[model samples]
Target: MSVHILIIDDEMNWIKTFSDILIDYQVCDAEDIFNATNLSDACEVLRNNAIDILFLDLNLGCESGQDAIQGLRAEFPNSTLVVMSGVTTGSIPLMCMERGAYDYLPKAMSTDELVLSIQKVISRVEHFDRVRFAPNDLSMVNTQLPFSSYVTQDEKLHSVFEYLKVVSMTQHPILITGESGVGKGVLAKAIAEYSRPNGPFVSLNVAGLDEQMFSDTLFGHTKGAYTNASSQRTGMIAKANGGTLFLDEIGDLSLSQQIKLLYFTQSGEYQRIGSDLIETSDAKIVFATNQNLIELIELGKFRKDLFYRLNTHHINIPPLRQRIGDIPLLIKKFVHQAAEDYAINVPHISDGLIELLKSYCYPGNVRELSSIVYNAVLKSDGQVLTFSDFEFPEIRDIESCSLNAEPETNDTSFKRLDDLFDEKIIDALRVSDGNQSKAASLLGVSQSTISRRLKKLQI
Candidate 1:
């Protein structure tokens, strides 16, 4: 289980001193240490053993340090390569990093600093291994909602998934913000499944909860606390102890309610309704919202202090329109799921239908697309689905607008044409509820084009 490290340097004294430092600091098992005076011997050692970390001296007498990086990387792709040299001029360190070196250290650094650098690399390697290998041993097999079910082929989404995996290992409070139906809640659940698989996962929508209701729901209520309280009750914080407590629609919370929630989060203590006893919870807090909290804070609807507290670790889920590559995969998954739920055969989707689905700006995001697919499948009699089964009201409106327009004839008609153009733009804006991107989709134009027209027309 001990880490294996290889030191490649031509200087015997440097190699001996660094090896002694590593061994004395218990960086890894002393027997696991390997040394090579040049790239040839280093490659041979790499071929024979798996080196977790490789310390390569860039200034090897007659040899160039940069020349060895590619060869070492080719042979030991998994090893964390650290370039060290007495020469600190030029872009050597940057070049090493660009060529995939884990870190660069100066040979003049003290032993303590060298130990710290080695420790940092080891920590990162261990974290990566933990996250990478966790899926096999974690409670993923027992959970109904597996991480793989979140259908995404986009590189950005994959990176987001990786970030989520790394952050899930910690108990930091996460604030997830995005447009409605962008799957913030789903991501939160995925985090909980990975981070606290054995513990309970509780959720609550804090939108409509007044101060009293928020308190009763989040901090629990004692017997005879209110008109409907007949017995003792446990709230979400208590129920989610040792696990995750996801609060959806967090932006809708009242300012007073925000203060109370912030107090609980800051102090980890809360008082139940009708009880003077203070209680503490160990639940991991995950908050999500569709609204812009900064705007709300500027408008005095949300507390600034609470916003600062919750903004520590924030993730912005990109909307479906932004990640169009994921549309087809999501469509297929939703269609199959719907077919299974309806006890019918899975319907075949056409390439044309998929293309049409990709063109539209899904304002309601993934949830809207899922609903469209499910409805089409239910209404379809044939095995293969076509565009006829899909009802896009926005598309119809755009078509109607185009069909109703008349051609301008002369210079005298230019004024009328301008008026008509303004009317059409206004109509598109109205159809899209003032969302310029959605309006652009409705008009079959780019968002930038819409913005230019809006500015030119002075609308």
Candidate 2:
């Protein structure tokens, strides 16, 4: 994408060199006051130039670059401003970025670094575009505590959260399936809160555990079981008795451990590592995995019986790309939380910036979002985060549809059938207060259809 960049510096030599380095992009320069007699004239130049980006020097003669940034931001809200300065670090760049500079660069930067920064800015803008315009249906059930400061506008995520509230009320084992960083742990914790607010909520990542350790850690030993067993020890399952037990990456459990887990799940009973006697714990089990268990079962990596047992009540999280609409909401939520955590003011988001985030595929999902916002907040140093804080991946390798184009297929075609589908379903569900059968009947659809559609669309 060729972006029109406006250079608002007074140095003729540096401006010429800067424009030369930006040969891959379109650069417009205002080298001296003669080019723009006054602030109004400068604003007029920016207004008429149809500029996408601004490279403003810190010293703009008697007029400071700070004033120009503020003026241009007010005049051209869509333009992404870049603050370039010979002076390193301090309040000026912060003020510039806070006022709405897309990025800040040292005037002495190498041609390569300068070009890279510009490309990064362009990539972010593109990513945001891909996510902002997609449609979704978002709902808020009773917000649970430890109330996931993790933000996502993704309708699918909201629905998962809503379903999590209801599923949390039961002791049925929950199988959470998703790609890594889709907030499975958050969902598990939310379920734990729902099960027993005051009871113990213990979580174990079963990924690295061996057979003996897995059994021992889950079911406590009664003194003298092993060489290290100097005294009786309570395991996580026992510790979580009457509460929730979360097993993360349960797909990583060995076959033997899977059998042991299945036995306990089936009968609510387990045996410690060296004990013959059976012990029972009434803890609710919630397991999460990024793996496809069906494939795992077919490959003989995961046990079929265990998969079925854990999947009694399942929650599959959609990835970031599927829920593009959630990008801005998540970004806004993250910015606010980051500002609060860092004791800084919340930053403003540019429309182009929003479009940039939506365009990229967040392979790391919501966790990536948190990291990006946190880093951006640190870089901003109390200023608003610009496209500069966000580092985009190489765009040449990404698929076009995942970047700039609208999704060719709306797999959730049921949503497109009619707007009434949403209104009727939501209205019935609300009036019935989450009675599936009643809601289905009210909508004149079979209960099975309602269940099937909800499972398919994950709403």
Candidate 3:
């Protein structure tokens, strides 16, 4: 898609020249914004389009263009603002900087300089979007693709979900561990949503955190505290104060950093680097990892004390291989997702193909399965998903089956209500690793149900 550029220049000749230059560089919708003499008019245009870059003139007729830019900057903060003018006043650039103008460009500069400035602005904006979720766009479902809606009929899967539902009501830290593609992150998000349905939930992988970036990203730094710090910033931990903070790949944390994190878990207090005052953080913490921390502790790579602190509520996500019966539902969901993403009609799946998928051992688990469906959607020439769309290794041994069970007649047996209830409660406890609230979500029941059941069962 072409980048949307909005130009606000009073000089008609300059506007025309710049529009031509932007068009030559493959930018789209390079429209004159000087027609928007007032903030209200500019805002109307901004609201109408997806603007990637805004070029604002420093002076509009009878109004300080800086003030107008400041107002537009507040409303369209995600759109990069580049100050463009024939007026070479230093104060204008400084003022625009204070109002969050992305960069300054002189009208007399060559086409190369203009294009380079735009490229730099685009790069910075993409990075900013990755780290920051705009409030307006936070809840909007991405129209490109849809993901699987969790389903449960298997006793083991249902029990785990029930446990997650219950533990989500509390503010305690939750630790989730499982093989990759086992939906550890998905489970973490489900817990966050249950805890604070109306609040923001922020997530990031802590595996890349070194000492400095971790501090700045989590606790936020004040202006002038660091060499390049230009403004006071809110960190992820601060941003999610009333909600939840999901730290994926927590097992990758270094031992020393784990000690630092332990302090936050212990006392709900944090201090920005180069600051003496301690600020309290009240966000619930959810950590996930595919690695076994016990092995890390054995090798002296992980801190035992920090592990215990985070282990107050634990969850273990089961791999897809253990839940082969779910493959059909998962594949159906992925096919619909692919159809939506690619703007194509949803294709039907054959029973032969479904049986073939169930027979194969998915090494990458659900993630791999989703990818296969996505590819099949793009490659399938017919309206239905058939075995021809798939390529698989020959079935080797009965032991090689994903479920580790011999192929037999479809089992539709059921337990008595009492036995079913007991089994579900126990399975919830196992998946939650004994965390009651998280167990509740997995079971599609309220925390009270699990609590009351536990009381009756005396578990």
Using lDDT as the measure, which candidate wins? 1
Q: Which candidate do you rate higher for lDDT, 1 or 2?
A: 1
Would you list the rank order by TM-score, best first?
1, 2, 3
Clashes of 2: 15
What candidate 1 gets wrong by more than 4 Å, as runs, is 1-146, 393-459
TM-score of each: 0.58, 0.55, 0.54
Clashes found in each candidate (C-alpha, N, C closer than 3 A)? 0, 15, 21
lDDT digits (tens) for residues 1-459 of candidate 2: 445666777777876677776664442233311233245555777767756666778787787777777777777866667778898754555455546566678988887787788776665444433333334222544233443543555655665665565556666788888888878888778777766888888999989988778878889887999898999888998899999999999888889888888998998888776689888888989899998777677678888668656764678887777777778888887888888999987766555456655655666778887788777877777765554566533232225346344333334422332343544455556666778886665544677876776776678
Q: Output the TM-score of candidate 3.
A: 0.54
Whole-model lDDT per candidate: 0.76, 0.69, 0.69
The worst-scoring run of ten residues by lDDT in candidate 1 lies at: 395-404
Q: Is candidate 1 or candidate 2 better by TM-score?
A: 1
Stronger candidate by lDDT (1 vs 3): 1
